[model samples]
Target: MTKDSSPTQLTHFDQQGQAHMVDVAAKQDTHRTAIACGVIRMKAETLAIITEGTAKKGDVLGIARIAAIMAAKRTSDLIPLCHPLALTRVHVDFSITTETNTIQCQAQVETVGKTGVEMEALTAVQVGLLTIYDMCKAVDRGMVMSDIRVLEKHGGKSGDWVSLIDQQDHN
Candidate 1:
């Protein structure tokens, strides 16, 4: 294995590299929730078009919300490592901050499962943000996607972690 390989490579996969999914069956089924976020950066004018619901592609937030929810529910199908989970609930919130001229998409995924919901949450946000970029590309071809990350995670063996990005604002 290369020195730059991820720690996950050392822990999860075997030497045969058959790509087996991790078994969380022995782990306790705890209520888990993960909040993931991503940003869609575009021209100020393009944002105004989204804000005004004037985009020819239709309701930006509405489509993004549905996309995120659907992505969360289908996480197992999209990623091989993720376990199929009966998610208790999924919530996606969209906010546009004029200060940064960016659209922030946040996905909160909740479930009572042996494995965590971080991947589901992250996937939802990524797809949702990408959908936005696709929809608005005609107006802003240079749209940039950035800062796709988990903002918070809870109810797992590792306990909880809140992103330093969130903590920095509080201090």
Candidate 2:
């Protein structure tokens, strides 16, 4: 490949700068996985409402879990540059921290495809957190979403990559 056609160049644009899908047909399929995380900070009372399962909208975590899975599957529809992928596995997790008055959302997405699933994982985490906000917004509209990021990814030519921030927190 010529230096002009290096993969580092933007993949979502053609020579004319028009938008187009990156062709992955020639790329080898590999087992790809990505994990993303984010947090929603809210009032303590709002957190109590969610924890007690009395938000009037029913179960906050349950609804958020479903939303995250659905969002991961429909990622291509939401993000124009993302490719439609047949995901093999998708998991969404949530934790509530009283100290921070925060709800943390994490999503792990896996697929055997040519492209990475970082976008899918990130989308899932974001949608999951949004669902929480929507369900609890009636009681608390001041909630803030922050630290949305990909925690890790593996497979493809890039191999494995992990976020140092997440690692440090765990340690």
Candidate 3:
């Protein structure tokens, strides 16, 4: 964004309000990374079943990890006006919070490209959490997936940005 640009400006739209993909042909390819997070809050028993590997669907985290990686690669197909990035790395991790009865999903995506991978990271986290929900829905359909957002992004023309919540989490 420039000095005259508003933060609310939708970059995906043209002046005529027609949707289009942002052109990155002029932008230099740089090593970029993004991290996104989401949490799926479920019943305690549901969490226990997943953590104890007793779910009928087999390994929850393993399946979710694979699903997240595939989602990252397919983000361009699912979302409009997104560049198909050649991501070099995609890592999906999960943490089970027994006390909170939640499963936290995080996806860190790295790519050497002209555009940012924030959308890819976000998509990965969401799909990963959704996979968990899908595999465990038989046990807990009421599971709530929330707080899905990009926690941080690095290596862009505008430099790096980190969410305040993520900064507070580090402290």
Per-model TM-score, in order, reads 0.89, 0.93, 0.94
After superposing candidate 3 on the true structure, give the runs of residues whose Cα lies further than 4 Å from its correct spot.
1-7
The 10-residue segment of model 2 with minimum total lDDT is: 1-10
lDDT tens per residue, model 1, 14-98: 5676666776766788999999999998899999999999999999989989999999999999997778999999999999999
RMSD of each: 3.8, 1.9, 1.8
Top model number, TM-score? 3
Top-down lDDT ranking: 2, 3, 1
The CA-based lDDT of model 3 is what?
Answer: 0.92
For model 2, the superposed segments whose C-alpha errors exceed 4 Å read 1-8
Number of colliding residue pairs in each model = 0, 0, 0
Clash count for candidate 3 is 0
Candidate 3 per-residue lDDT, tens place, 1-171, comes to: 223446589877778888887777878999999999999999999999998999998999999999999999999999988899899999999998899999899999999989999999999999999999999999799999999999999996877999998789889
TM-score of predicted structure 3: 0.94
**Quality of model 2 by C-alpha lDDT:** 0.94
Candidate 1 displacement at residue 77 in angstroms: 1.2
Q: Least accurate stretch of 10 residues (summed lDDT) in model 1?
A: 1-10
